[model samples]
Target: MSDQQENKVVISLDDLLAQAQLLKKQIDDLSAARAELLDSVASIEAAKASIQELKTQQEMLVSSDKKGYLMFKINNQPPQKVLVYLGLSYYVEVDMDTALKILDERENELKEASTGLDKKLAESKAAYDQIVDILNQIQAQAQQKGE
Candidate 1:
């Protein structure tokens, strides 16, 4: 055998396929995580906009599936406080400014998490591509040997 052929590192086809499967799973999981993070960010933005709107609006429409929609009149007075969710089913009542700040912080955290997941997803996809390339090369080599 030539030196070039002797220096080749042989990897099992089955093992490569298994690794590709695992990488595909990882990519899917990362994509789901990133999607959740983005959803959280959007929720935060909506909350921030509602808070800002409440400062200027005196009347609002509230709705529930069981009660339908109700128009509430605030006597031309803005709300003094609002409840902010702090994860794990915990909520705190605070002034509008404080609530906005908390939401901003939470949005930032979610954005950071999404960004991290994006990086991991990219890496997993690259690994999956490399595995597929290796499998294709193996298939081509087997065909050549058979010929």
Candidate 2:
């Protein structure tokens, strides 16, 4: 090839390499974000399960006198009042109705947040796929030029 043609090939390869590196970084960032979202979803689901258990216990308490092991074994205790978290290492004792209301509100908030995260994950995946397609095209072009 002429010097000019060779220069063009070298420049194109360099450009493609730079683009690949940037896309790889973006993919890594997106993967990390997705992982975080998954973790949050898992945590919220676990919290929801705990709230459901508490709600069940509250119902049982209202019906009749019964004792159950706290934290599965800390101590057998009667469910008289519920301790509700008030954020930042604070908790307030509240009646069953009030505590259930708070839990319901928290559940709704978590559901909304989960929905938003799902949308963000979908968008990130789409962007990642497009970048991958572009990278593949670049690789094919490079291979063709090399032949």
Candidate 3:
């Protein structure tokens, strides 16, 4: 009894190979999907970082435009120059906002992909467990017949 408990149950090579082929294929597909999910996550993170940097730049441009407005009042600078600079700030802000939206969408897509991969992995594991159980049953029956 102790020997059986101490030693892990194992299947013969022929049975293991025959049953495991399908499970192995499923595992391989799940692994590939997981890798793609990770890649998507990395891309989303990088996009988020890029959006943050763009946000910082946009804020800086807005402050610069405000400074230009004050200088226009004090230095009597040309109105056209202030208007053009303000327009640049608006464009930068709008572009940064769009980038942030895309980053969020990508993050959501990654989340969905990860969930799908997790489900596939669980199903593959269940199938493998079933195969193992069958192998164990066959081995036990053989031992009993021998006795």
Best by lDDT: 1
User: Model 3, poorest ten-residue lDDT window?
Assistant: 77-86
Instruction: Report the C-alpha lDDT of model 2 over 43-128, residue by residue, as the tens digit.
Output: 54654565566655533222222233332332334355778776689988977667767766765665676677567657756765
Name the best candidate (by TM-score): 1
Per-residue lDDT of model 1, residues 1-147, tens digit only: 799999999877788999999999999899888888897798799789878888987775554333566555455577789999998999999999999999999998888888888999999999999999988898999999999
What is the number of residue pairs that collide in model 1?
A: 0
Relative to the unseen true structure, what is the C-alpha lDDT of residue 55 in candidate 3, on a scale of 0 to 100? 41
Candidate 1 vs candidate 3: which has greater TM-score?
1
- Candidate 3 or 2, higher TM-score: 2
Q: Which window of ten consecutive residues has the lowest lDDT sum in model 2?
A: 59-68
Q: Candidate 2 or 3, higher lDDT?
A: 3
- Regions more than 4 Å wrong, model 3: 1-19, 57-94
lDDT of each: 0.86, 0.62, 0.65
List the candidates ranked by lDDT, beginning with the highest: 1, 3, 2
RMSD (CA, angstroms), candidate 3:
13.9
**Model 2 segments beyond 4 Å from truth?**
1-77
Clashes of 3: 0
lDDT of 3 by residue, 70-133 (tens): 3222223212211111223552233555656655776787788899889989898888988877
**What TM-score would each prediction reach against the true structure?**
0.83, 0.57, 0.56
